[model samples]
Target: MSAITAAEGNPQIEFWFEFASTYSYLAVMRIEAAAQAAGVDVVWKPFLLGPVFLSLGWNDSPFNIYPPKGRYMWRDLARLAARYGLPFRMPSQFPRNGLLAARVALVGVAEGWVAAFSRAAMLASFAEDRDIADDAVIGELLAALGLPAPEVLARAQAAENKQALRAQTERAAEIGLFGAPSFRVGEELFWGNDRLEDALAWARAGP
Candidate 1:
C-alpha cells in the first residue's frame, strides 16, 4: 500500500499498515528504530483494511466476527505488547474509523512528517484510547507535531487527497495485501509483526 525507498545502494522495505489493526500498533512503534538499526529505509503505507475484508466476504475484523478468535487475539496481542515493552490498552471501540487519519497521513507523507504523525496517531488510539475518527483528535496530532493544523487539515481533506488515499487502498488490494503491518521487499511480502525483523533482514541483505 505504501513504499519508502532510499537512494540507490540503500536497502528499503515497504511497510503496509492500517490504523485500526491491533498488531499494527506493535509494528508501527517498532519499525523505525529497528530499521535504523538494520540500516534500512522504510516506507509507510496507510491503507483501509475494510474494503479488503469486504472482498474476503467479511464485514468486520476477523477477531470481532469470531468470539474465540477475538479472545485469543486480545490475549496474544497483550502478551506480544509486553514482550516488546510497548503499551497496549484495549480500546472500547474495536476498529475505529481511520479514514480521516489516513487522509491526513498522505499530507504528512508529502510534508515529510508521516512517521511522527503515524506514531502519535497510533499512541493516541492504542495507548490512550482516544477516538481517532474524530477530526479534533487528528488536528491535535498534527498541531503537536508543530504542523499547521488548519492548513494541513485543509490539504488532507481536499478532494485530491481523498482520491489519493482511495488509489492507495486499491493498490494495496491489487498487490495481494490481505492485512496490515505487512512488509515488502521487491516482490516478497512478509505479514505480521513477528515477521518485521525478517523483512528488515531481507532488505538489509539486498538482492
Candidate 2:
C-alpha cells in the first residue's frame, strides 16, 4: 500500500504522523510518491501528540515552549520546503488542533482515501490557514472529497472512533514515539521527515 493502493506482498513501513506537526505536513505531501518510488507500502497512522507531550511532562509543543527552538524550526522548515520545491507558508496558528482531522483521517485510512484526504487536510492546516478543529472546516474537507460530510462526521464522532484514536495515541507512547512523521520498519523506528528515505530503504531491504 503506497499510502492509498494496497499492493500485497510488498515491503511496508508504518508512517505515524500527527496532523499538528510541521514536519508531518511536509511528509504527508510527499510520502505516497516516495514510497511508490522505493517500491514500499505505507501504513498511514494518525495519532495525537498531546498525551505524548503530557507523558514527557510538557503541556504544549516544545516549539511553543522554547522560543529559540521554535525560531530555528520555522527557519529550517522554510529552507527545506524551498529545497523540496513545495509551497512554504507560515501558518497563522502554531499547531492547530488536529484531533478531529486525525479522527477523519483514521476513517480515510480504512476507506482507502487516506493519502488524498491527508494531503488536502495538510494543505488546509499549513497553507490555507484553516482551523482544522472546526466541524465546518472538516465537513468542507470531506465534501471536497465527494464523501457525505454529515455521515462521515457522525461516524468519526462515534464513541468507538473516539476511543480508537485514544488507544492509538497510547500505543504511540507504548512504542516510544515522542514526535510525528515517524516511520516504523518492524521494531526499528526512524524519527523526523529527513529520515523518511532511510526508513523506506530499510523496508525495501527487508527486516
Candidate 3:
C-alpha cells in the first residue's frame, strides 16, 4: 500500500527514535520512503530511553529482564532486518550505552546533521554489529558522515549537548512517550515501528 496523503490540511509527523532501539532502526530505514510518497515531512526527534525506563523503575532492558521476550526480540529483529535487505547480526552488548550517541544526535539535530548522523549510528550498531557504546565507533560514524570527528565528539560530550539530550528524554516522558520509534502527528501519539503507517494515515486525516 502507498503512504497516506492529506485530503485537505494536516500537521507534519514527528518521529522519535533511540539509537539503542532495534525496531527503531527498521522504522528509520523505511519511514523516509513512505513519507516521501505520502507527501509528508517528518521531523526526526532523537532521544534517550534510559530516563524513560528509569522513571518506570526499570534499570535494565525489559527484554533482558524477560528471557523469552529477549529471545523473541532478537529473532524478530533478524527477520525484519533481512526482510528490509539490511544486515542482521546481534551485537555483543545487549543494550549499548546510548548516552553518547544521544548527545551526538542532539548536536547533529542542532547542526542539521540529524538524518545523516542517525543513519550512520544506527547502521554501525545494527548492520555492522559495532559497539555503539564506544566513543571510537561513534567518532568513526561521525567521520563517515563527513562531520568533523573531533568537533562533533567534543560537542557531543559538551555540557550543552548532554543537557539537550537529557531534556529531550524528559520531554518524551512528558509527552507520554514511553517507548522508542514513536510517531506524533500533532497531539496524536503512535508507538512502535508497526504503527508508523497508522500514524501517517492519521496525519493525512488531520488531528
* After superposition, candidate 3 runs with Cα above 4 Å error: 1-10
- lDDT string for model 3 (18-87, tens) is 8888888888888888887786778888898888988988888888888999999999988888887987
CA lDDT of each candidate?
Answer: 0.90, 0.91, 0.84
- Ranking 1 against 2 by lDDT, winner: 2
Compared with the true structure, the alpha-carbon lDDT of candidate 3 equals 0.84
Q: Whose lDDT is higher: candidate 1's or candidate 3's?
A: 1
Give the C-alpha miss distance for residue 131 in model 1, angstroms.
0.4
* Superior candidate under TM-score, 2 versus 3: 2
Question: Candidate 2: minimum summed lDDT over ten consecutive residues — where?
Answer: 1-10
For 91-203, candidate 2 gives per-residue lDDT tens digits of 89887899999999998888888898889888888878888899999899889999999998898899998999999999999999999989999999999999999999999
Model 1 residue 43 CA deviation in Å:
1.1
TM-score for candidate 1, please give it: 0.95
- Range of the 10 consecutive residues with the lowest summed lDDT in candidate 3: 1-10
What is the TM-score (0 to 1) of candidate 2?
Answer: 0.94
